[model samples]
Target: MDEGRPIFQQIAERVENDILSGALVEEGQVPSTNEFAMFYRINPATAGKGVNLLVEQGILYKRRGIGMFVATGARERITARRRELFVLEYVAPMLAEAASLGIEPDQLGQLITDQLTAGRLSEKETR
Candidate 1:
Protein backbone atom coordinates (compact mmCIF):
# COMPACT_ATOMS: atom_id res chain seq x y z
CA MET A 1 0.00 0.00 0.00
CA ASP A 2 1.52 3.27 -1.11
CA GLU A 3 0.93 6.08 1.34
CA GLY A 4 1.08 8.57 -1.51
CA ARG A 5 -1.88 7.15 -3.42
CA PRO A 6 -5.48 6.37 -2.64
CA ILE A 7 -6.09 2.87 -1.25
CA PHE A 8 -8.91 2.25 -3.68
CA GLN A 9 -6.69 3.14 -6.60
CA GLN A 10 -4.02 0.79 -5.28
CA ILE A 11 -6.57 -1.97 -4.95
CA ALA A 12 -7.71 -1.40 -8.51
CA GLU A 13 -4.13 -1.45 -9.83
CA ARG A 14 -3.39 -4.66 -7.93
CA VAL A 15 -6.26 -6.36 -9.72
CA GLU A 16 -5.12 -4.90 -13.02
CA ASN A 17 -1.57 -6.17 -12.41
CA ASP A 18 -2.93 -9.62 -11.62
CA ILE A 19 -4.90 -9.65 -14.86
CA LEU A 20 -1.92 -8.44 -16.85
CA SER A 21 0.30 -11.11 -15.29
CA GLY A 22 -2.19 -13.82 -16.36
CA ALA A 23 -2.97 -14.63 -12.73
CA LEU A 24 -6.54 -13.63 -13.48
CA VAL A 25 -7.88 -14.78 -16.81
CA GLU A 26 -10.82 -13.48 -18.82
CA GLU A 27 -14.16 -14.81 -17.53
CA GLY A 28 -12.42 -16.00 -14.36
CA GLN A 29 -14.21 -15.10 -11.16
CA VAL A 30 -12.49 -12.57 -8.93
CA PRO A 31 -12.64 -12.59 -5.17
CA SER A 32 -15.71 -10.90 -3.74
CA THR A 33 -15.43 -7.36 -2.45
CA ASN A 34 -15.80 -8.67 1.08
CA GLU A 35 -12.91 -11.01 0.50
CA PHE A 36 -10.81 -8.13 -0.74
CA ALA A 37 -11.75 -6.05 2.28
CA MET A 38 -10.82 -8.81 4.66
CA PHE A 39 -7.58 -9.54 2.89
CA TYR A 40 -6.53 -5.91 2.86
CA ARG A 41 -8.11 -5.04 6.22
CA ILE A 42 -10.16 -2.34 4.61
CA ASN A 43 -13.82 -1.40 4.59
CA PRO A 44 -16.00 -3.48 2.30
CA ALA A 45 -17.30 -0.35 0.59
CA THR A 46 -13.75 0.79 -0.15
CA ALA A 47 -12.92 -2.57 -1.71
CA GLY A 48 -16.15 -2.44 -3.70
CA LYS A 49 -15.30 1.04 -4.91
CA GLY A 50 -12.03 -0.27 -6.35
CA VAL A 51 -13.74 -3.24 -7.97
CA ASN A 52 -16.50 -0.99 -9.30
CA LEU A 53 -13.90 1.21 -10.95
CA LEU A 54 -12.87 -1.76 -13.12
CA VAL A 55 -16.48 -2.62 -13.80
CA GLU A 56 -17.12 0.90 -15.04
CA GLN A 57 -14.06 0.63 -17.26
CA GLY A 58 -15.46 -2.60 -18.83
CA ILE A 59 -12.55 -4.59 -17.39
CA LEU A 60 -14.91 -6.66 -15.28
CA TYR A 61 -18.54 -7.80 -15.28
CA LYS A 62 -21.06 -9.37 -12.96
CA ARG A 63 -23.17 -12.44 -13.68
CA ARG A 64 -26.42 -11.88 -11.79
CA GLY A 65 -26.09 -14.08 -8.70
CA ILE A 66 -22.52 -15.00 -9.49
CA GLY A 67 -19.42 -13.02 -8.53
CA MET A 68 -17.50 -10.56 -10.66
CA PHE A 69 -15.34 -11.91 -13.47
CA VAL A 70 -12.67 -10.51 -15.77
CA ALA A 71 -14.09 -9.18 -19.04
CA THR A 72 -13.23 -10.57 -22.46
CA GLY A 73 -10.27 -8.76 -24.03
CA ALA A 74 -9.49 -7.17 -20.69
CA ARG A 75 -5.81 -8.02 -21.03
CA GLU A 76 -5.49 -6.33 -24.40
CA ARG A 77 -7.49 -3.34 -23.22
CA ILE A 78 -5.25 -2.99 -20.15
CA THR A 79 -2.11 -3.35 -22.22
CA ALA A 80 -3.22 -0.67 -24.68
CA ARG A 81 -4.17 1.72 -21.92
CA ARG A 82 -0.91 1.07 -20.01
CA ARG A 83 1.18 1.59 -23.13
CA GLU A 84 -0.43 4.98 -23.66
CA LEU A 85 0.23 5.90 -20.05
CA PHE A 86 3.81 4.69 -20.29
CA VAL A 87 4.47 6.99 -23.23
CA LEU A 88 2.87 9.92 -21.51
CA GLU A 89 4.29 9.36 -18.05
CA TYR A 90 7.73 7.94 -18.79
CA VAL A 91 8.76 8.34 -22.42
CA ALA A 92 7.66 11.94 -22.74
CA PRO A 93 9.44 13.02 -19.58
CA MET A 94 12.55 11.09 -20.56
CA LEU A 95 12.64 12.75 -23.96
CA ALA A 96 12.16 16.17 -22.40
CA GLU A 97 15.00 15.58 -19.96
CA ALA A 98 17.27 14.27 -22.71
CA ALA A 99 16.58 17.33 -24.84
CA SER A 100 17.29 19.63 -21.90
CA LEU A 101 20.63 17.84 -21.46
CA GLY A 102 21.43 18.26 -25.21
CA ILE A 103 21.35 14.49 -25.67
CA GLU A 104 20.54 13.61 -29.27
CA PRO A 105 18.07 10.87 -30.12
CA ASP A 106 20.84 8.56 -31.29
CA GLN A 107 22.80 9.14 -28.10
CA LEU A 108 19.72 8.47 -26.02
CA GLY A 109 19.06 5.26 -27.90
CA GLN A 110 22.63 4.10 -27.32
CA LEU A 111 22.42 5.03 -23.66
CA ILE A 112 19.24 3.03 -23.27
CA THR A 113 20.79 0.03 -25.00
CA ASP A 114 23.85 0.28 -22.80
CA GLN A 115 21.73 0.37 -19.65
CA LEU A 116 19.72 -2.64 -20.85
CA THR A 117 22.89 -4.59 -21.49
CA ALA A 118 24.23 -3.68 -18.07
CA GLY A 119 20.95 -4.74 -16.45
CA ARG A 120 21.05 -8.10 -18.25
CA LEU A 121 24.60 -8.67 -17.13
CA SER A 122 23.72 -7.82 -13.53
CA GLU A 123 20.76 -10.21 -13.64
CA LYS A 124 23.00 -13.00 -14.94
CA GLU A 125 25.58 -12.34 -12.23
CA THR A 126 22.88 -12.48 -9.50
CA ARG A 127 21.57 -15.84 -10.77
Candidate 2:
Protein backbone atom coordinates (compact mmCIF):
# COMPACT_ATOMS: atom_id res chain seq x y z
CA MET A 1 0.00 0.00 0.00
CA ASP A 2 1.33 3.42 -0.92
CA GLU A 3 1.02 5.97 1.87
CA GLY A 4 0.89 8.75 -0.66
CA ARG A 5 -2.26 7.54 -2.39
CA PRO A 6 -5.70 6.49 -1.21
CA ILE A 7 -6.03 2.84 -0.22
CA PHE A 8 -9.24 2.42 -2.20
CA GLN A 9 -7.48 3.50 -5.40
CA GLN A 10 -4.73 0.98 -4.74
CA ILE A 11 -7.29 -1.73 -4.19
CA ALA A 12 -8.98 -0.87 -7.48
CA GLU A 13 -5.63 -0.89 -9.29
CA ARG A 14 -4.83 -4.33 -7.85
CA VAL A 15 -8.00 -5.75 -9.39
CA GLU A 16 -7.22 -4.02 -12.68
CA ASN A 17 -3.71 -5.48 -12.60
CA ASP A 18 -5.15 -8.93 -11.96
CA ILE A 19 -7.48 -8.61 -14.90
CA LEU A 20 -4.77 -7.26 -17.18
CA SER A 21 -2.47 -10.14 -16.21
CA GLY A 22 -5.23 -12.65 -17.09
CA ALA A 23 -5.67 -13.79 -13.51
CA LEU A 24 -9.28 -12.58 -13.59
CA VAL A 25 -10.77 -13.39 -16.95
CA GLU A 26 -13.87 -11.82 -18.37
CA GLU A 27 -17.03 -13.14 -16.64
CA GLY A 28 -14.92 -14.68 -13.85
CA GLN A 29 -16.04 -14.01 -10.31
CA VAL A 30 -14.06 -11.69 -8.10
CA PRO A 31 -13.66 -11.98 -4.37
CA SER A 32 -16.31 -10.38 -2.24
CA THR A 33 -15.76 -7.02 -0.60
CA ASN A 34 -15.73 -8.72 2.77
CA GLU A 35 -12.94 -10.98 1.60
CA PHE A 36 -10.96 -7.99 0.44
CA ALA A 37 -11.51 -6.25 3.76
CA MET A 38 -10.26 -9.27 5.66
CA PHE A 39 -7.24 -9.70 3.41
CA TYR A 40 -6.18 -6.08 3.63
CA ARG A 41 -7.41 -5.49 7.19
CA ILE A 42 -9.63 -2.70 5.90
CA ASN A 43 -13.27 -1.87 6.48
CA PRO A 44 -15.78 -3.72 4.31
CA ALA A 45 -17.23 -0.41 3.19
CA THR A 46 -13.79 0.76 2.07
CA ALA A 47 -13.26 -2.42 0.13
CA GLY A 48 -16.67 -2.07 -1.45
CA LYS A 49 -15.86 1.47 -2.45
CA GLY A 50 -12.82 0.20 -4.29
CA VAL A 51 -14.86 -2.48 -5.99
CA ASN A 52 -17.57 0.02 -6.85
CA LEU A 53 -15.05 2.17 -8.68
CA LEU A 54 -14.59 -0.67 -11.16
CA VAL A 55 -18.32 -1.27 -11.30
CA GLU A 56 -18.87 2.35 -12.22
CA GLN A 57 -16.16 2.14 -14.88
CA GLY A 58 -17.83 -0.90 -16.50
CA ILE A 59 -14.89 -3.10 -15.63
CA LEU A 60 -17.11 -5.22 -13.39
CA TYR A 61 -20.73 -6.19 -13.04
CA LYS A 62 -22.86 -7.58 -10.25
CA ARG A 63 -25.42 -10.39 -10.22
CA ARG A 64 -28.26 -10.09 -7.73
CA GLY A 65 -27.70 -13.49 -6.13
CA ILE A 66 -23.98 -13.64 -6.79
CA GLY A 67 -20.84 -11.59 -6.18
CA MET A 68 -19.11 -9.34 -8.70
CA PHE A 69 -17.54 -10.57 -11.91
CA VAL A 70 -15.26 -9.09 -14.51
CA ALA A 71 -17.06 -7.48 -17.43
CA THR A 72 -16.47 -8.46 -21.02
CA GLY A 73 -13.81 -6.23 -22.68
CA ALA A 74 -12.54 -5.10 -19.31
CA ARG A 75 -8.97 -5.98 -20.22
CA GLU A 76 -9.13 -3.99 -23.44
CA ARG A 77 -10.66 -1.02 -21.68
CA ILE A 78 -7.97 -1.13 -19.00
CA THR A 79 -5.21 -1.40 -21.57
CA ALA A 80 -6.48 1.55 -23.58
CA ARG A 81 -6.91 3.69 -20.47
CA ARG A 82 -3.45 2.77 -19.16
CA ARG A 83 -1.85 3.59 -22.50
CA GLU A 84 -3.43 7.01 -22.46
CA LEU A 85 -2.26 7.57 -18.91
CA PHE A 86 1.26 6.45 -19.82
CA VAL A 87 1.45 9.03 -22.56
CA LEU A 88 0.07 11.76 -20.32
CA GLU A 89 2.15 10.92 -17.26
CA TYR A 90 5.41 9.72 -18.81
CA VAL A 91 5.79 10.30 -22.52
CA ALA A 92 4.71 13.93 -22.54
CA PRO A 93 7.04 14.86 -19.72
CA MET A 94 9.93 12.96 -21.23
CA LEU A 95 9.38 14.66 -24.57
CA ALA A 96 9.36 18.08 -22.94
CA GLU A 97 12.58 17.29 -21.09
CA ALA A 98 14.22 16.04 -24.25
CA ALA A 99 13.28 19.21 -26.08
CA SER A 100 14.71 21.31 -23.26
CA LEU A 101 17.96 19.38 -23.59
CA GLY A 102 18.06 20.03 -27.34
CA ILE A 103 17.52 16.35 -28.11
CA GLU A 104 15.51 15.94 -31.32
CA PRO A 105 12.86 13.26 -31.66
CA ASP A 106 15.18 11.22 -33.88
CA GLN A 107 17.95 11.45 -31.32
CA LEU A 108 15.55 10.37 -28.60
CA GLY A 109 14.51 7.39 -30.73
CA GLN A 110 18.11 6.34 -31.23
CA LEU A 111 18.87 6.76 -27.53
CA ILE A 112 15.89 4.58 -26.63
CA THR A 113 16.97 1.91 -29.13
CA ASP A 114 20.52 1.96 -27.79
CA GLN A 115 19.31 1.51 -24.22
CA LEU A 116 17.05 -1.38 -25.23
CA THR A 117 19.88 -3.12 -27.07
CA ALA A 118 22.22 -2.66 -24.11
CA GLY A 119 19.58 -4.02 -21.72
CA ARG A 120 19.01 -7.09 -23.95
CA LEU A 121 22.75 -7.77 -24.08
CA SER A 122 23.04 -7.46 -20.30
CA GLU A 123 20.12 -9.86 -19.82
CA LYS A 124 21.71 -12.38 -22.18
CA GLU A 125 25.02 -12.17 -20.30
CA THR A 126 23.23 -12.80 -17.00
CA ARG A 127 21.47 -15.84 -18.50
Candidate 3:
Protein backbone atom coordinates (compact mmCIF):
# COMPACT_ATOMS: atom_id res chain seq x y z
CA MET A 1 0.00 0.00 0.00
CA ASP A 2 1.23 3.47 -0.83
CA GLU A 3 1.17 5.77 2.19
CA GLY A 4 1.44 8.86 0.03
CA ARG A 5 -2.04 8.27 -1.38
CA PRO A 6 -5.37 8.44 0.41
CA ILE A 7 -6.27 5.52 2.65
CA PHE A 8 -9.34 4.81 0.59
CA GLN A 9 -7.21 4.47 -2.52
CA GLN A 10 -4.87 2.15 -0.65
CA ILE A 11 -7.79 0.04 0.45
CA ALA A 12 -9.05 -0.13 -3.10
CA GLU A 13 -5.57 -1.16 -4.23
CA ARG A 14 -5.41 -3.88 -1.60
CA VAL A 15 -8.60 -5.39 -2.95
CA GLU A 16 -7.27 -5.04 -6.49
CA ASN A 17 -4.05 -6.75 -5.44
CA ASP A 18 -6.05 -9.59 -3.95
CA ILE A 19 -7.93 -9.96 -7.19
CA LEU A 20 -4.77 -9.83 -9.26
CA SER A 21 -3.03 -12.36 -7.05
CA GLY A 22 -5.93 -14.84 -7.37
CA ALA A 23 -6.91 -14.48 -3.74
CA LEU A 24 -10.16 -12.87 -4.89
CA VAL A 25 -11.66 -14.62 -7.89
CA GLU A 26 -14.38 -13.48 -10.21
CA GLU A 27 -17.84 -13.90 -8.63
CA GLY A 28 -16.14 -14.55 -5.29
CA GLN A 29 -17.51 -13.02 -2.12
CA VAL A 30 -15.74 -10.04 -0.65
CA PRO A 31 -15.83 -8.90 2.94
CA SER A 32 -18.30 -6.20 3.81
CA THR A 33 -17.27 -2.66 4.64
CA ASN A 34 -17.68 -3.37 8.33
CA GLU A 35 -15.51 -6.45 8.07
CA PHE A 36 -12.89 -4.48 6.18
CA ALA A 37 -12.95 -1.84 8.91
CA MET A 38 -12.50 -4.43 11.63
CA PHE A 39 -9.67 -6.15 9.81
CA TYR A 40 -7.79 -3.00 8.83
CA ARG A 41 -8.72 -0.95 11.89
CA ILE A 42 -10.10 1.75 9.62
CA ASN A 43 -13.46 3.48 9.80
CA PRO A 44 -16.28 1.68 8.06
CA ALA A 45 -16.97 4.72 5.90
CA THR A 46 -13.36 4.77 4.74
CA ALA A 47 -13.50 1.12 3.85
CA GLY A 48 -16.77 1.64 2.04
CA LYS A 49 -15.26 4.46 0.04
CA GLY A 50 -12.55 2.08 -1.10
CA VAL A 51 -14.93 -0.73 -1.91
CA ASN A 52 -17.19 1.71 -3.68
CA LEU A 53 -14.32 2.78 -5.89
CA LEU A 54 -14.06 -0.79 -7.13
CA VAL A 55 -17.82 -0.86 -7.61
CA GLU A 56 -17.62 2.29 -9.70
CA GLN A 57 -14.88 0.69 -11.77
CA GLY A 58 -17.03 -2.41 -12.38
CA ILE A 59 -14.48 -4.59 -10.66
CA LEU A 60 -17.00 -5.36 -7.90
CA TYR A 61 -20.74 -5.41 -7.50
CA LYS A 62 -23.30 -5.30 -4.69
CA ARG A 63 -25.83 -8.07 -4.02
CA ARG A 64 -28.56 -5.93 -2.45
CA GLY A 65 -29.21 -8.09 0.63
CA ILE A 66 -25.75 -9.62 0.60
CA GLY A 67 -22.28 -8.09 0.44
CA MET A 68 -19.93 -7.52 -2.54
CA PHE A 69 -18.65 -9.96 -5.11
CA VAL A 70 -15.89 -9.76 -7.67
CA ALA A 71 -17.30 -8.83 -11.05
CA THR A 72 -16.78 -11.05 -14.09
CA GLY A 73 -13.40 -10.50 -15.79
CA ALA A 74 -12.34 -8.30 -12.87
CA ARG A 75 -8.79 -9.66 -12.90
CA GLU A 76 -8.31 -8.94 -16.58
CA ARG A 77 -9.77 -5.48 -16.20
CA ILE A 78 -7.50 -4.70 -13.27
CA THR A 79 -4.46 -6.07 -15.09
CA ALA A 80 -5.17 -3.98 -18.17
CA ARG A 81 -5.80 -0.86 -16.13
CA ARG A 82 -2.65 -1.40 -14.09
CA ARG A 83 -0.61 -1.93 -17.21
CA GLU A 84 -1.85 1.35 -18.64
CA LEU A 85 -1.06 3.08 -15.39
CA PHE A 86 2.42 1.54 -15.32
CA VAL A 87 3.18 2.91 -18.76
CA LEU A 88 1.89 6.36 -17.86
CA GLU A 89 3.39 6.43 -14.38
CA TYR A 90 6.67 4.53 -14.77
CA VAL A 91 7.60 3.78 -18.38
CA ALA A 92 6.93 7.28 -19.65
CA PRO A 93 9.10 8.81 -16.97
CA MET A 94 11.93 6.38 -17.62
CA LEU A 95 11.80 7.13 -21.31
CA ALA A 96 11.72 10.88 -20.72
CA GLU A 97 14.70 10.65 -18.38
CA ALA A 98 16.63 8.54 -20.80
CA ALA A 99 15.90 11.00 -23.61
CA SER A 100 17.14 13.86 -21.45
CA LEU A 101 20.33 11.89 -20.79
CA GLY A 102 20.86 11.44 -24.54
CA ILE A 103 20.20 7.70 -24.34
CA GLU A 104 18.90 6.38 -27.66
CA PRO A 105 15.82 4.19 -27.72
CA ASP A 106 17.74 1.14 -28.90
CA GLN A 107 20.42 1.73 -26.28
CA LEU A 108 17.76 1.93 -23.58
CA GLY A 109 16.19 -1.28 -24.83
CA GLN A 110 19.56 -2.98 -24.73
CA LEU A 111 20.18 -1.63 -21.25
CA ILE A 112 16.89 -3.06 -20.08
CA THR A 113 17.67 -6.41 -21.69
CA ASP A 114 21.15 -6.43 -20.16
CA GLN A 115 19.72 -5.66 -16.76
CA LEU A 116 17.24 -8.49 -17.15
CA THR A 117 19.89 -10.93 -18.31
CA ALA A 118 22.23 -9.95 -15.47
CA GLY A 119 19.41 -10.16 -12.94
CA ARG A 120 20.17 -6.61 -11.91
CA LEU A 121 16.67 -5.32 -12.44
CA SER A 122 14.02 -5.85 -9.80
CA GLU A 123 11.07 -8.12 -10.39
CA LYS A 124 8.98 -5.15 -11.43
CA GLU A 125 11.57 -4.07 -13.98
CA THR A 126 11.69 -7.54 -15.48
CA ARG A 127 7.97 -7.45 -15.80
Candidate 4:
Protein backbone atom coordinates (compact mmCIF):
# COMPACT_ATOMS: atom_id res chain seq x y z
CA MET A 1 0.00 0.00 0.00
CA ASP A 2 1.12 3.61 -0.59
CA GLU A 3 2.25 5.75 2.31
CA GLY A 4 0.21 8.41 4.06
CA ARG A 5 -3.52 8.40 4.69
CA PRO A 6 -5.31 5.32 6.02
CA ILE A 7 -4.92 2.10 4.08
CA PHE A 8 -8.66 1.63 3.90
CA GLN A 9 -9.11 5.01 2.22
CA GLN A 10 -6.44 4.12 -0.32
CA ILE A 11 -8.12 0.79 -0.96
CA ALA A 12 -11.41 2.60 -1.41
CA GLU A 13 -9.84 4.87 -4.03
CA ARG A 14 -8.25 1.94 -5.80
CA VAL A 15 -11.62 0.23 -6.08
CA GLU A 16 -13.18 3.46 -7.27
CA ASN A 17 -10.47 3.93 -9.91
CA ASP A 18 -11.01 0.38 -11.14
CA ILE A 19 -14.72 1.00 -11.45
CA LEU A 20 -14.19 4.29 -13.23
CA SER A 21 -11.70 2.77 -15.66
CA GLY A 22 -14.08 -0.04 -16.66
CA ALA A 23 -12.17 -2.60 -14.67
CA LEU A 24 -14.57 -3.54 -11.85
CA VAL A 25 -17.55 -2.14 -13.84
CA GLU A 26 -21.22 -1.66 -13.09
CA GLU A 27 -23.32 -4.48 -11.62
CA GLY A 28 -20.12 -6.42 -11.06
CA GLN A 29 -19.56 -8.46 -7.97
CA VAL A 30 -16.99 -6.69 -5.85
CA PRO A 31 -14.44 -8.81 -4.15
CA SER A 32 -15.61 -10.24 -0.87
CA THR A 33 -14.26 -8.51 2.23
CA ASN A 34 -12.11 -11.53 3.00
CA GLU A 35 -10.82 -11.70 -0.54
CA PHE A 36 -9.92 -8.06 -0.57
CA ALA A 37 -8.26 -8.36 2.80
CA MET A 38 -6.28 -11.42 1.78
CA PHE A 39 -5.27 -9.96 -1.59
CA TYR A 40 -4.05 -6.72 -0.08
CA ARG A 41 -2.65 -8.37 3.07
CA ILE A 42 -4.73 -6.09 5.20
CA ASN A 43 -7.12 -6.72 8.09
CA PRO A 44 -10.56 -7.88 7.01
CA ALA A 45 -12.02 -4.95 8.88
CA THR A 46 -9.89 -2.57 6.86
CA ALA A 47 -11.06 -4.14 3.65
CA GLY A 48 -14.64 -4.00 4.88
CA LYS A 49 -14.14 -0.33 5.72
CA GLY A 50 -12.92 0.42 2.22
CA VAL A 51 -15.85 -1.44 0.67
CA ASN A 52 -18.23 0.33 2.99
CA LEU A 53 -17.16 3.73 1.68
CA LEU A 54 -18.30 2.76 -1.79
CA VAL A 55 -21.51 1.41 -0.32
CA GLU A 56 -22.19 4.83 1.19
CA GLN A 57 -21.42 6.58 -2.09
CA GLY A 58 -23.89 4.35 -3.94
CA ILE A 59 -21.06 3.00 -6.10
CA LEU A 60 -21.67 -0.34 -4.39
CA TYR A 61 -24.63 -1.90 -2.62
CA LYS A 62 -25.25 -5.09 -0.70
CA ARG A 63 -27.60 -7.80 -1.88
CA ARG A 64 -29.91 -9.35 0.72
CA GLY A 65 -28.76 -12.91 0.19
CA ILE A 66 -25.49 -12.27 -1.57
CA GLY A 67 -22.43 -10.06 -1.40
CA MET A 68 -21.86 -6.53 -2.60
CA PHE A 69 -22.31 -5.57 -6.21
CA VAL A 70 -21.61 -2.35 -8.04
CA ALA A 71 -24.58 -0.04 -8.49
CA THR A 72 -26.15 0.01 -11.94
CA GLY A 73 -24.51 3.29 -12.99
CA ALA A 74 -21.46 3.07 -10.76
CA ARG A 75 -18.99 3.64 -13.58
CA GLU A 76 -20.49 6.93 -14.68
CA ARG A 77 -21.08 8.09 -11.14
CA ILE A 78 -17.53 7.28 -10.06
CA THR A 79 -16.11 8.93 -13.17
CA ALA A 80 -17.88 12.19 -12.50
CA ARG A 81 -17.02 12.22 -8.81
CA ARG A 82 -13.40 11.20 -9.27
CA ARG A 83 -12.70 13.84 -11.91
CA GLU A 84 -12.81 16.46 -9.15
CA LEU A 85 -10.21 14.56 -7.16
CA PHE A 86 -7.92 14.19 -10.19
CA VAL A 87 -7.50 17.92 -10.48
CA LEU A 88 -7.41 18.79 -6.79
CA GLU A 89 -5.36 15.77 -5.72
CA TYR A 90 -2.87 15.51 -8.55
CA VAL A 91 -2.80 18.10 -11.34
CA ALA A 92 -3.30 21.24 -9.26
CA PRO A 93 -0.59 20.36 -6.78
CA MET A 94 1.85 19.36 -9.52
CA LEU A 95 1.23 22.64 -11.32
CA ALA A 96 1.77 24.60 -8.14
CA GLU A 97 5.04 22.77 -7.50
CA ALA A 98 6.15 23.33 -11.08
CA ALA A 99 5.43 27.07 -10.82
CA SER A 100 7.31 27.22 -7.53
CA LEU A 101 10.36 25.60 -9.09
CA GLY A 102 10.22 27.72 -12.29
CA ILE A 103 9.87 24.57 -14.42
CA GLU A 104 8.76 25.54 -17.90
CA PRO A 105 5.88 23.91 -19.82
CA ASP A 106 8.26 22.27 -22.31
CA GLN A 107 10.30 20.84 -19.43
CA LEU A 108 7.19 19.26 -17.88
CA GLY A 109 6.16 17.83 -21.26
CA GLN A 110 9.61 16.32 -21.76
CA LEU A 111 9.56 14.84 -18.26
CA ILE A 112 6.17 13.23 -18.78
CA THR A 113 7.10 11.89 -22.23
CA ASP A 114 10.35 10.42 -20.89
CA GLN A 115 8.54 8.80 -17.99
CA LEU A 116 5.91 7.28 -20.25
CA THR A 117 8.53 5.99 -22.70
CA ALA A 118 10.59 4.50 -19.89
CA GLY A 119 7.51 2.90 -18.38
CA ARG A 120 6.58 1.27 -21.71
CA LEU A 121 10.14 0.05 -22.21
CA SER A 122 10.21 -1.38 -18.69
CA GLU A 123 6.92 -3.18 -19.27
CA LYS A 124 8.25 -4.67 -22.52
CA GLU A 125 11.35 -5.93 -20.73
CA THR A 126 9.24 -7.62 -18.04
CA ARG A 127 7.10 -9.29 -20.70
Cα RMSD to the true fold for all candidates: 1.4, 0.9, 3.9, 4.3
- In the range 42-68, model 2's lDDT, one tens digit per residue, is 889989999999999999999988989
Candidate 1: residue 106 lDDT (0-100)? 99
lDDT of 3 by residue, 66-116 (tens): 889999999999999999999999999999999999999999999999988
- Residue pairs that clash (backbone atoms under 3 angstroms), model 2: none
Q: Residue 19 error for model 1, in Å?
A: 0.7
Which one wins on TM-score? 2
Estimate every model's Cα lDDT from 0 to 1: 0.97, 0.97, 0.95, 0.90
Cα lDDT tens digits, model 4, 1-127, are: 9887899999899998788777886888988999999999999999999999989999899998799899998888887877898899998999889989999889998999999999999999999
Give the higher-TM-score candidate: 2 or 4.
Answer: 2
Question: Which candidate, 1 or 2, has the higher TM-score?
Answer: 2
Off by over 4 Å in 4: 90-127
Pairs of colliding residues, candidate 1? none
- Stretches > 4 Å off in candidate 3: 120-127
